[model samples]
Target chain A: MTDTVMTEKSELPVHMRRAEFDPVPELAELRDGPAIARIHTVVGSQAWLVTRYADVREVLGDQQRFSHARFLERRPPGMADLSDEEIAQARAGNLLAQDPPDHTRLRRFLIPEFTVRRMKRLEPRIREVVDENLDAMEKEGPPADLVANFALPVPSLVICELLGVPYVDRAEFQARSNRMLDLSVPPKERTRIARESRAYMAKLVAKAQAEPGEDILGMLVREHGDDLTTDELIGIASLLLIAGHETTANMLGLGTLALLKHPDQLALVRDHPEAVEPAVEELLRWLSIVHSGIPRVTTTEVEIAGQKIGPGELVVLALPAANRDPALLPDPERLDVTRGEMGHMAFGHGIHHCLGAPLARMEMRIAFPALLQRFPTLRAAGTEPGFRSFNVIYGLTSLEVAW
Target chain B: MVSDEQLLRVRADRDVCIGAGMCVLTAGAVFDQDDDGVVAVLDETPEDIDAVRRAVANCPSGALSISTGTPAGA
Candidate 1:
C-alpha cells in the first residue's frame, strides 16, 4: 500500500524546520530571545509569534484578548475575499473558525461523542482496527511503508466508520485532505480541493439527513439536526475527517521513526506496559505536529510578555516552539518519555483545544504497543523516511519499516 | 490552625469549559463532564493533587484551577 516517499522540498515557514527530535534553531531563536517575535507567514502579513511557553499559555488561555475567528475576518493579502455569507458558511460548525456561543453550541453537540469515557468504550474497536492493519502488514511481509499500511489507514478507517464516511472513498478524501493542507500546492488549487471535500461530505450528510445511521454523523442528524444547518453538518463532518486523517498518522509515522532512532526509548515503550502513556505524551511533545493552532487576532489592546500590541494585530502561537521551550521542562530538547511532563500544547490550549485529542491518544496508545508486540524485530527499512515539512502538520509522508 | 498549604482543592468553571476532557484523561478522580461536555468536578479535593495539577495545566480552556486551603466549588 506504500507510495514512494514525498520529496517535495519547499521552504518551511519560520515557525517550522526539518528535524526529528526538537524544534530546530529557526524557532528556538524566537522562543529564547524575546517574549514575542514578528514572523512573516506564507499566506499572511507579518504577525506576532509567541513562542515562549508562558506567553503562549497566557495568549491561548485568554480568548477575550486572542480571538482566532476574528483574525480570519480580514483575510491575508494574497487570499481571495470571502463575502459575509461565504465567511459564515465557512465558519459554520467549523470549531476553529467560530468562537462561542456559536462554537460552543456546535461543539456541545459532538462532545458526548468524544468524551474520555466514551473513547474508552471505543478501545476494543480501536484495538481491532489496529490489529486489522497490523495483520495486513504482516501478511504483506517486511519492508512495508507504515504510513500507508498502518499509520494512515488506521485513523482513516476509524474516522470513516465513526463519521459515516464510506471506507471505499478513503483514497479520494485522503488525497483531497492531504493536498488541502499541502503548503507547496497553490492556494487557489487548495481552495478548489477544499470545496470538493465539502461537496463530498455534503452528500454523505444528505444521506444521513434522510436516514441517520449509528455513526457520529447519524448521531448529529438525529440529535442536533434541527439545531444545525446542512452546511454546518457538512463542515463539521469534513473537518473531523481532515483533522483525523493525518494528525495522528504523521505522529504515528514520525513517532515510529523517532523511536527507531532512539532504540532505548523504543524498547521502553514496547517492553513496559506502564511506559506507553508517558511515551505517547513525550512523542506528542517532541513532535508537536501541528505548526500553530491558528493565527489569533487581538480583540483589544494586549500585553503579551510586556509588548503592548494595539487592537486588531494578528498573533500566532507556535506549539512546536512552546513545547520545546526550557520553561516547559528542565531539558525540552531531549525526547525523554520518562520526564513526566504533561502540558504540551501539541493539542493547542484554551477554548479551541483539539476535539479529537482523546481519540488520537487512544489510537497511539494501542497502535504503538501492538505494532512492537507483533513485530519486535521492526526496524526502519533502508528507504529514507520522507517528512511533510511544508504541510500545516509536520509528519512523514512515508515510513518504510520492516520486521 | 492548619496552614493554607495543608489543603488542596480544585475548581471548574463549567461556563468556560470547552469539553476537551483532558481533566478526566489526566485526573478522572477529580473531574468528569456532563452530557453537553461541561466539566464535572468529581472529588474537588481529591488526594491526587499532582494529577489535578496536570489536568489544570493541560486544560485548553483554563476552566480548571487549583488552590490550597480553599474548598473547591465553594
Candidate 2:
C-alpha cells in the first residue's frame, strides 16, 4: 500500500521493515506479485530482491550461478591498497565468504563437531546452561530485562563455551557484535568495529595456536594445524562467534516475547515436551530473525523467476517474507507450533545454509521451553519492548518481563 | 526378505551435499555426516521413520531421499 520502493540509494535501507513479529505488509504484497524487485540496499548498492518462496530457493540453491564468495569480494575501502592475496587471506575460512570446494574443505573439519551426535553430547551441557540462566532469572525475581538477563546471556554463554571465548571477554565482545550487526551504525564505524573484533579474535586464535584447548578453536588447531593459516583460523572463529550468539540470542529474546504474546503457544512449548521440537522450528520460521539474508553476486548473467540479471549484480533474498509466503504453506502468517517441517528458509537453503543451525536449534529448544516453565506467569512489564530496527538481525533491544 | 537384503533404502547424493548437517540433526539414526560434511546414512529403516521423513524435508540440498526396500534382519 505504502511506497515500498526504496527510491533513494543513500536512504537508510532498514526503513520500516517490520510488523512486530511479521514482515511489513509491503514485503508480502511484493512476494505475491512481482516475486522479484530491484531495491536500494543498506550499503548504497542497488540489488535484486527475490521474495517468494520458490524464487528465493532458486537463488540459494544455485551457488554456481549466485556466488556467495564473490559477495564479499569487494575490498574494504580502507584496505584498497592491500594485495588480492592478502584480501583473499582475510576471507580465508569464513564459511559465508566461501563456496563449494573451499567451503567443503574447511567445513568438513568443523562438521563433525556440529553433528547431531556432538550436539547430543552437548545436550546435557545445554540443558545445564539453560537451567543456570533460568536459575539466575528466578533468583533475580520479576521486572527483569529478559534481553540482558536471559535471552542475551544464554546464547552468548553457550557460544563462548563452544567457541572457547573467555567468559570475561563477553562484555566487550557482545558490545562489538551489537555494533557489528546493527546496520544503523555508519559504515566507517562498522569498519572500525570489524577491525577491533578481528584483532580481539586474532589474540584468541594465537592462544589456541600455542596450546589448543578443548573448544572449537582448539579442535581446529589440534586437527588442522598444518593446513590452516592464522587468518583462516581467525575468520572461522569470528564467523562462528558472531553468528552463533547473535542469531540464537535474537531468536530467544524475540521468540520468548512471541510466546508471551500468545499464551496458548507459550503453554504448548512449556508444558509439552513433544511440542518443544516443533515449536522451535515454528519459531524460527515465523520470526526469520535475519530479515534479509546476505547478498549474493551473480557469477554470470542469469534469469531468476523470469527476471534477467547481468554478471556481478547483487541479489538479496527476502528470507522473512519467503518463509511467510502463502505459497510456502497453508496459513503461513499464523504462528502455529503444531506445523513443523514446512521447509522454512529461516536457516536459509542450499549449500551455505547455516552451519550453526543445529546448535541454534538446540539452544532455542532448550531455552524457550525452560524460560516458559521457569516463569509460568511470565508477561511483559516495565519498559515497552523496543525493536532493534537497524540491526541486520531483527530482535527486541530489551524485553522487560515479570512473572 | 533376508539379512543382507537392502531394507528401508535411503539414498544420499553427495554430489549436491554441502554438508550443513540438517539431516543428521533431524534424523540422527538415519543420517550422519562424513568428515567432509557429506551425508552418511547409518540406518535406512530407523525406528523413527517420521524423523527420517523430517530429515529428508529439512535437507538444505535435496540430496537425501527415502524409498521402500526389502525387510531387515529377516
Candidate 3:
C-alpha cells in the first residue's frame, strides 16, 4: 500500500469531517483492495484504516492482539488541534482507553452501580426525566429543538443523577462537555474544559463522600474508600458523564428523527408498546451512533480477513459500516423496527460494549412512544434537520419538531 | 416475586468474557467475578422478573438470558 500525502483541508480536526464522508461509497468500493490501507488522516498523520466487517470486528474483539491505551500515549491523528496538556487530559486512562489488567481493575469499581437491576430501578425515573423534558417542550410549543429539549436533557439528567451530581448545574456540565468534544475549538480551550470538568467532578465526588447519596459516586466512595484516588474518581465520573449522555442523547434524537421519517415503523412502535424491545435493536442498528467503534493499536502481528496487520498500527472498527454490512443483515439500509437484528454491533460486540446500553435502550423505549403518543401530530419543523459534523458520532444539532 | 422457573436464565461463556463487568454493574446478584476476574454466574434463575430482565439488558458479552418456561431456565 502506497502512502499518499495531502494538505490539510481546514483547521478543523479530522473528526469533524462528517459531511465529507460522501466518499464512503467510494471507500466501500475499495474495501477489498487492501484490508489494511495506509491513508493520510484529515490531520496529515499516517494511520491504518480497517474497512471491512470481519477485520473491524477482529480488531475490536482481540484485546490481546490489539491495545487501546497505546493510541493515547501519542497524539491521535485527528486530535492534532489539541494542545499537549489537552491531549494528555483527553488520553487519561478511563475504561474506554485501557486494556486487560488495568481495564479490569477500573471497570470492576463501576460494575455494581451500572447493573441492569440498578438501571431498571432508574427506568421509571428516566421516564420521568423524559416526560418532564417533553412537558417543557409542550409548554414551549412548535418548532422546538428535540436535541436541546428532549434528547439532550433526558440522558444528561439521568447521568447526573446516577453520578450524584446536582442537576441544577447541568448547564455548566453540558457546556463544558460540548466544548470538550468540539473539534473546531482551540486546543487550549478544549484542555481547559477537560480540566474544568475534572475539577467539577472532583467537587461532586467530594460532596458525595461527605454525605453519600444513592448515586454511583456515593457507592464508589463507600466501597473503595482510599483505594479510589480523587483523580481516578474524577476520571471515572467524567467518562461516565460523557459516555452516558452524549451517545444516548444522539440516539434519542437521531432515532426519533428516523422514526418520524418512516411513519409505518413509527406506527409499529406506537401501536405495540411491547415492540419497544425489538424496535430499540433496530433503532440502534439504523442510527449506529458510535459512528466508528473505539480505536485499537495492534500489539502483535495479526491477520484479519486474510490481510496481515503489523504491530503498532492503529485500527478503527467502523461500527456503522459493520452494522450495515449486507453479509450480516439483509437489506441493511432499511430501518425495520421489527427486523431480526439480534446481533448487530450497534452497542458493539464482545468486551468494551456500551455499559450504559440498558439505560440507553430503556430511555429510547420510553422516550420514543411517549413522544409520539404525547403529540400525535409531531413532525420535524422542516424538511431538513441540522446535523453535527463529527465522525465518532452521528448527532442532530437541532431537530425542531412541532405538533 | 417471580419463581426461579419463571425467571430468565442468563449465562456467558466464561472463556469469552473479557471482564468488562457490565453484567455485575447492571445486575450484581445474577453475575459476579471469580478470584480470577472471570465472570461467574451467581444465580442462573433470578427471583425478580425485573432483575432478570435488567441482567439480560446489562450483559455486555450477551451472556445472560430470560426463561420462556418449558425447559424452565437455561
Error of 1 at A297 (Å): 0.9
TM-score of predicted structure 2: 0.91
| Tens-digit lDDT track of model 1 for A1-403 | 1111111234445676756656668678756766577666656466787888888888888878788779756643444743567556666778888777777888888888899888898999999999999999999978899999999999999999989999999889999989988887886776677677777988999999999999999999999888889989988998899999979899998899988888998899999999999899999998889988788988899887777888988888888888888888887888887764468888887778889999999999999989989999899987788877777888888888888
Model-by-model DockQ, in order: 0.73, 0.48, 0.18
What would the per-residue lDDT of candidate 2 be over residues B1-74, giving only the tens digit for each residue? 32546666677898777677888767777788776557888876677878887878778878988776667432
Pairs that collide in candidate 2 are: none
Locate the minimum summed-lDDT window of 10 residues in model 2 chain A. A7-16
Q: Cα RMSD for candidate 1?
A: 5.1
lDDT of 2 by residue, A6-102 (tens): 6565454532278688787877877787677778886677788888888888889888999988888887544455578756766888888887888
Error of 1 at A315 (Å): 1.0
True contacts kept of each: 0.79, 0.60, 0.23
Question: What stretches of model 1 exceed 4 Å from their correct place?
Answer: A1-11, A76-84, B1-8, B67-74
Model 1, residue A263: C-alpha shift (Å): 0.5
Classify candidate 1 by CAPRI docking class. Answer: medium
TM-score per candidate, chains pooled: 0.93, 0.91, 0.82
Query: Candidate 2 at residue A310, lDDT?
Result: 94
Tens digits of per-residue lDDT, candidate 3, A1-403, equal 5323232545322222344212245344445355445555444455666656666766666778878788767775444566786555554447787776777677766765655555677788888887898889999978788899999998898888888878899889888877766556665666567678877887887887898777788888888867876667777888888888788888888888888888988888888887777898888876677656566788888776566778988766656566666766677767788874346677776568776776787787788899888888888886478777643466787788888
Candidate 3: stretches off by over 4 Å: A1-23, A32-36, A75-93, B1-74
